[model samples]
Target: MAVGDPTVRTTPAVNETGEGTSTILQTRDLRKEFGGLTATDDVDLAVEESELRCLIGPNGAGKSTFLNLITGRLEPTAGSIYYDRFDITGLPSHERVDRGISMKFQVPSLYEEFTVRQNLRIPLQRAVESDVFEARTRELLDQFDLLTEIDEPATSLSHGQQQRLEIAMAMGLEPKLMLLDEPVAGLSVEETAEIADILQTIQAKEGVAFIVIEHDIDFVEMIADRVTVLDQGGIFTEGTIEEVTSNPDVKRIYLGEDD
Candidate 1:
């Protein structure tokens, strides 16, 4: 379906307590540190079944570190995380994936020498429990307009194409919550727009909630239903795009006065 099409139900909205009937993911006072430096500090966030939340911050603001802590790539120094109400703070990355959380990094991860179709097969193999693996893969390929490139070596695709491929692979898992870190990083304006369109389309149709970490305000504004800003490892401010953009403190600390 097209981006923002009302018919496709990707995720359910938050309930009365600002939580999903089935809270897909949650973090309570989550913190991460490296030696003397703190990367994430007391982060408390929640993602309902299919809510699209954008996390934005300046460089060194700990966006990546926070994502690592959630996905089990890095252990949190303190606090806890929950997936479907089950504690997952100590779970390994692979185990979390098996539990229904998937992440797509800013850098495209794929088998460069393998054809796009071959690259896709790896995830499909892992998704054996998914009844519609093949069909889902086909749909993802079509969604990204990469069906023709299925037979071409992944290394042969352009940077933009590679980005799309990585997203497609992540979607193949049918994740309950998708963590996308800078999915549009390094792409041209046009390329970013294309990827943005695909993301919007996926959310509308599949109800796959997303926690997108990005520096591109324009892009985040276009995709995020709500925006959260991080500064110096702490939540700086949060609100609608307009509210956050207009906040004087957010401007001074995160966006820069002139931004």
Candidate 2:
């Protein structure tokens, strides 16, 4: 598809502040440390509203740590995080969710014994300030193609199905920005493609921005409008997928060879 093709539904408009739109999420010299080690080092990043930005790096590059900082799972040793112009550095994870930010972790987090519908109801109930929780829960199950398995125990579902269900749970919150941490991590190629299509559809319909951290380069290229490459806890480079993929330095450092 063409870049920013409305029909393809990958690229959406820039943010609301005109040409130079304000970021939906921004970090200034964000840092995290474990004793003498700097897990995330002076990282600066911004995610525009409705944009699907991918964060990719080798293992131990602090991708998850950076995500933890933003989601308030781990406190930053230094710097700040702003969401929608509000300083949310001190907010708890649930409060951040309340403020229209939600996340799906790399691992499928579900209530193993609970039926699919019951598992989904947890987030539905939490996001129930204005919308009807039950209706939203039903809608998500349908949207994610989990309606058939709604009555099955979460553990009884396939790995791919469980992944979809976890994401559906996050979507139950109707978030403005969603952080998907390896949403397709353990799925098969076909399963990954299915989830990717669902994500694109959701992005098109809802205009929900996302920061996806994934190791699968193909998967990232498929969904990312912009790619941020991290190395040793800092941003090594960032550009459109086309730019980053062809970059010599990116290839040498991350891909370990010329393309």
Q: Give all candidates' CA lDDT scores.
A: 0.84, 0.87
Candidate 2 root-mean-square deviation in Å: 7.8
Predicted candidate 1 versus true structure: per-residue lDDT over 1-259, tens digit per residue: 9955678654222221223354677788889989999999999887767788899988999899999998899999999887775778899999989877888997668988899988887877787655766676677799999998878999899998998999888887778789999998889999999988888888888888899998888899889988989988988888788998899888887777954
Q: Looking at candidate 2, what is the lDDT of residue 92?
A: 91
Q: Please, what are the lDDT tens digits per residue for candidate 2 over residues 129-222?
A: 4457667777899999899888899989999999999999989888999999998887889999898898898889999999999988889878
Q: Which stretches in model 2 have alpha-carbon errors above 4 Å?
A: 1-20, 129-131
Residue-level error in angstroms, candidate 2, position 78? 0.5
Candidate 2's displacement at residue 77, Å, is: 0.6
TM-score of each: 0.88, 0.90
Angstrom error of the Cα, residue 34, model 2: value is: 0.8
